[model samples]
Target: MASPKLTWNIALAGECMAARPFSVHDDEESMRVINLLRGADLTYAHLEMNLAHSRELEYPNRGDWLGSFMMADPAVARDLKWAGIDIMSVAHNHSLDFGPAGMLATKKHLQEAGVEAAGTGLDLEEAREPAYLETRHGRVALISTTSGNKPNEWASLGKGGYKGRPGINPLRASFNYVLTKEAAEQMKAIARELDVLRQADGSTMGTGLKDNEFSFQMPGDQSTRGSNVFTAGDHFEIQSRCHPRDLAGNLRSIDEAKKMADLVIVAHHYNIADGKRREKVPTFVREFAHAAIDAGADIYVAHGWHWTLGIEIYKGKPIIYGTGNFFAQSEFIRRVPYDSYESWGHDMDRLPTLNPADHPLHPGLDTHNEAWWTSALMGLEMKDGQFVSMTLHPVEMGRTAREGTITRQTGQGDHALTDGRPLLATGETAERALGRIQRLSKNFGTEVTIENGVGVIRF
Candidate 1:
C-alpha cells in the first residue's frame, strides 16, 4: 500500500552538523539549502554529533581507538530545527560518545526543539521502534539503525530483575578476512613455532574474538594474530555481512512502520568499509538496503561513509547508498577532549591548544576528497507513495573547491564555534559533484540527467 498523499516532497540529507547557530546566516547558499529542507513533507538527516548538554555529563571516551569526541552546543538543536531538520537518525557511531545519558540528552533536546529522533532509547525495544512525524500531506515513520557501533553501545534487553542498557539501535555486521594459501601457511608455521595453535585441551580453535572483529571482528575474524593459523582460501578478499537477528529486527520495524504511517523510511548508518576493496559497496549493506525495500520501506538510505556512494532504484523505491556530509563541520567542533587527544598521542602538554584545522580526526578538512567536500541535497517527489521524480541539489560544504564563496558567518567571537553551512554548488562545481554521483549510480544502471545545473531522476 502506498501513502495516500499525492505529489508530496521529501528532502534527504546526510550527516546533520552545526555547532553554532546556523539560522543567523541567511546568505544565498544557506537560504538555498534551507529552502529545500523546509519545503519537504519529510526531511531526514543523520545526526553524527552529540549535543554537549554539558561537558560535565561526558563519560570517558568509548571510541578512543576508532574515533574522537564530537559535540555541538545543545542550542544547536534549536538552530537545526529552525533551519528545517524535522527528523534525525541518532543511531550513528558517535551516539554513545558520552554514554547513555548523553544519548538520551541529545534525543530529549531534539524533541524539545521540535525534531523527531529515531534508533536510540533506554531499551532495545524502544530503539528498534519507529519514530513518527505527522504532516498535512502524510504521516512519516522512520526506523533508524546503525552498523557502526561497539559492543557496549548496543541497547540490550534487561535480564531477570535488571534493567536494559540504554543505547543506540544497532545493526551489527560481520567481516570475513580472506587470506591466501601462502599467507595462511606462513601464519600456521608461526603459530606452531610459538606453540599457540592448540589449546591446553589439545583442540585447535580456528579463531579468537578480541582484536579482529570483522564479525564484530570479535577477537578472531582475522587469524593472523597470536599464534593462531586458520584455513586460507586461494585468493584474498573481504566479505561483509550483517547478523541475522539484527537484520530481522530492523525488517520487522520496517513492516511495523509501513502499517503505522503513510510513508515508511529506513535510515541506516553503516560506515564499515570493505578492507580488501574500498571502492565497492559492502556485501551486507547492499543486502540490507534491498531487504528494507522489500519489507515495505518507501526509502532506504545507507550512509555515514564520509563519502558518497551509489544510488539504486530497487522495486520502484529509492535506495540511496551514500549521502556525503550535509553539514561538514566536524573540524569546527569546539572542544577536542583530552581523551581523544591522548588517544592520538597528543596530551595537553605536548599540544597546548588545538586548532580544528590541525586536528587529525577530521580528514575531510585537510584532504581533497571529492565525496567529502561536495554532496547532494536530494529532493524526492512521490505520488501515492510511488516515486515520480527526484532532484539532486548540489551542496558545497565549505573548505573545499566544490563550495561557493562564503559570506563569513561565525559563532560569537570564537572561530571554532562558527556555523558549518553548505553553499549551493554552481557551474562546474555542481557539474562535477553530480557527475561523480552519476558515475557511481551508473554502477546500478540508474541514469541521472543533468538539467539546469542539477541532477534529475524520473521514474
Candidate 2:
C-alpha cells in the first residue's frame, strides 16, 4: 500500500512590519487578508521590526537611517496573532537595533500573543536554533537567518562558559575591489605600510599588502597570501559565503528540524541588491538555499529587499528569492533616533516640516511608492509531504480613503500606522502587480497563471 497521504496548506509572506494600532473593528481589507491566512494550516511571516513598547533608544542612532535601527509597538503582536500568523522569523538587520533587551522584548511580546518566533535568541547557538509549530495537519519547523547584518548585531558565544552574548543569527560576507595592475600595486604598497605597523604591535591579520589577483588570500587560508583586504583585476567581487561557523550551525539546525518536524521551512533575510528591480542574486544566497533544500527543507523563503525577486524550484523544493513587505507601516513608527536626522544634516525638529520626498534618503511617508509596496503571499499545498500546488496571492500594502475623503492626511495617509495594512489587489492593481511577478520570475523559467487577480505557479 502507498504511504499515508498527509495534506496541508502553508502561507508565507514577506516583511511584516505590523505597527498598526489594534482596533476592535478591523477594516474589510485587513479582515480579508487575515481570513486568507486562517485558511492555511500554517502561516509564516517575517517580523521585520522589533516590538518595543516604549520610545527609548538603547544605542546611538549612528546616522544610518536607511532602513536600519527600527522598532515597533509591542501591541502590534496581538494584532499579528489576530491576523492568524503562526510563526515569524525574527532575524533581520534591525533585530539588534535597540540591543538585546529590545530583541528579547520583541520575542516575549510575540510569544505572549501566541506567535512563535525564530532566528534570534539569548546567544549564538540559540539564535541559530529552529522554531517549531505543531499543527493538527503536521509539525512545521523554521530556521531563520539574515545575510545583511551589523557586526555588533551578531550573537556571540561566551568563553569559559560565562554567559553567551545576546544577538541575532548573522550570515557575514566580504567585499573586494578588482582593479588594474598599476592600481593594485599602489593598494599593495599602502597595505604593506599598514601591515608593518600592525605587525609591530603583534597583529596577525593581514593588512592586504602582500597579494594581488591570483595570489589573493582566502579568509581561512593560513598561508601568507591571506589579507584582511586585497586587490584583484576587473570588476569587484563579493564573497557571498556564509560565516563558516554560522553555516555549519544552521545546517545542523536544519538537520535537527528535519528529524523533529514533518515540514521544514528555512527563511532567510538577504538584500544584496537595491531598488524594486530583480537583480542577480548573490552566489552565497543561492548556495545556502540549495544546501537547505538538500538538507531536507521543504520550502525556502527569502525576504529583505522589500521587493519580489525571481522564483526557483530546486529538487522539487520552492525557493522564493524575495517576498517584499507584507505589512509596511514604517510611516507610522512612533519615534526616530536623533542621529537619523543628524545624518540628513538636520535635527529631529526638522522632520515634521520636511516631507519624505524632500529628504535625500528616506522610505518616504508614502509606503506605496515603488515595488516595495507591491508583494505577494505564497500559498502552498502539500500532499504526503510532497509539493502539489503553489499560488501567489498578490497584495497591495497601503491605505484607502473613507468614502469621498481625500486619501492623504497629516500622519494617517495611505500608509499610516493605523491605516497601513495589506489588502488583496483587485482590478488593475492586481493585474499590474501579478504581471510584474510574471516578468520577475520569467528568468527562472517559472510561468504563473493569473486568475481572479491571483497568480498560480505551473508547478
Candidate 3:
C-alpha cells in the first residue's frame, strides 16, 4: 500500500558501536541530542556492534579479520530503542565479531527491544531483503548492505545439499591500482623475476604477474576478478568497482521496497576509503549510491569511515555520504578475546590481563584523531514523496580538555560509559565540525549554510 502523498521527518545517525547500555540521562546537553532523535517521525542508526548474552557466547573472538571485536550487552538494544532509534542497519565489518551465535543473539535482542534490523539474516536472500517499519504517518522501508564484509563472511544460499551461511548481505567491491606506463613495465619485469605470470601453455598473461588479473587489465576491457592494475595515463591511484551481481541484487531490493512503502531508505556500510584517506567517499560508492537512487531509494546513507565526510543532492533527494561514529565506546568494552591482545603483540600467558585502555591500542586506533571524534546527525524532511529540507546537527564524542588527550585518562576498573557518549555540539566545536562537513560537501557541489549551530544544506 502506497500513500498518494508522504510527509514526515527522519533522523539519521552514522554508526552505534556502543559496548554498554545507555539511557536518557539528566544531563541537559545529552538530553538535547536524545530529544532531537525523539522529535523525528522515524529514527535510524547503524548498529555496528554485536549483542552478546554473556562473555561465553559473545566474546570468543569469532571474526577472523584484522578489525577489532565489537560486542555490547544484549540489553544495549533496549537502550537504542529507548533513545528513539526505530531501525538499525547491522551490516558492517564488526557485525560478526562473535560469529553466528552472537549475531543471532543480537537479532533476537533487537526484536525483543522492538527495534527493526535490516541487512543480515539466515541467507543471502533474507539478508538482501528490505525490512519495513510501520508508523502512523507512513510505512518506511529500509534496505541495508555493506561493502566491507570479509571474503568468507557473505550470506550464501544453500546449493545442492549444503546449508546456507548465516551472515550479512554483501555489496562486494574490488580495487584497481591505476599505474603509469613506466610503472606497468616495471611490474612486468618483476613478474619475469617472480615467474608467476605464465600458464602451463607457455602463453604470457597480462603483465605476467602473479594474480595477473590484479597486476594488469586490458585497456577498455571490463574489469575482472581480484584487484587489477590499469595503466591510465601518467598517474597512480587506486580505483574501486562494485561487484555487478551484488549491486544488482541490492537494487532489486530497493525497487521492491519502494513499491511497498511510502519512503525507502538505503544504508550502505563501506570501509573502502578514497585511497589511504578515510574521510573521502570512494567513487564506487557514489556510483552504486546513484544506481540505488535510480532504482527507487528515497534516501542513501553511508557509514563506516568513523568520520564525517559529506552530503549530496541527487534527483531532488538527499544522499548522505558519511555521518561518522555515534555511541563510539569501542575502548570501553568489558571483555575482549585473546586475539585482541595478540594483535597488540601482548602475550596474555606471560603477562597480567589488560583492558583496551591499557592494551596498547588506547585512545583507540583513530580516537586520537580529531575527525574520528566529531560528526553530525542528518535531519531530513519529506513531503509528497519529495525532499523538503536536510540539516546537519554537529555532534562530538571526545574529551580534548583533559590534558590535551583524546579522552580523559582512563582509570582502572571503570567502563567509562559517561565519557564516550555523543552530545550536541556548540560554540567553536560546532563551527570546526560543521566547517569540515561544509568543505567536504563542497567537493560534490553541495552547499551547506551554518544556521545558528546547525549545518543546513540548501537544495
Residue 85 miss distance in model 3 (angstroms) = 0.5
Candidate 3 Cα lDDT to native: 0.78
- lDDT string, candidate 2, 193-216, tens digits: 545312222246544343243233
Best by lDDT: 3
Q: Who is ahead in lDDT, 1 or 2?
A: 1
Tell me how far the alpha carbon of residue 431 in candidate 1 is from the true structure, in angstroms, after superposition: 1.5
lDDT of each: 0.77, 0.73, 0.78
RMSD of 2: 5.4
Model 3: ten consecutive residues of lowest lDDT: 197-206
lDDT computed for candidate 2:
0.73
TM-score ranking, high to low: 3, 1, 2
> Residue 271 in candidate 1 has what lDDT?
71
Instruction: Judging by TM-score, tell me the better candidate of 2 and 3.
Output: 3
lDDT string for model 1 (1-459, tens) is: 543666668899887755566788787757888888898877889887888566447565464453657777888899888878889888998888778878888898899999999999999999999999988877889999998677889999999989998988899886666678788667657766755443233225534444322111124533432322233688877777888899999999999998988888899998777763255788889989999999999998878877677888888899898888878777677666666665665556766676444446554444356576678999998787778888998877653444433333444443332245677887676788888889989999898999998899989
TM accuracy, model 3: 0.89
Q: What TM-score fits each model?
A: 0.87, 0.83, 0.89
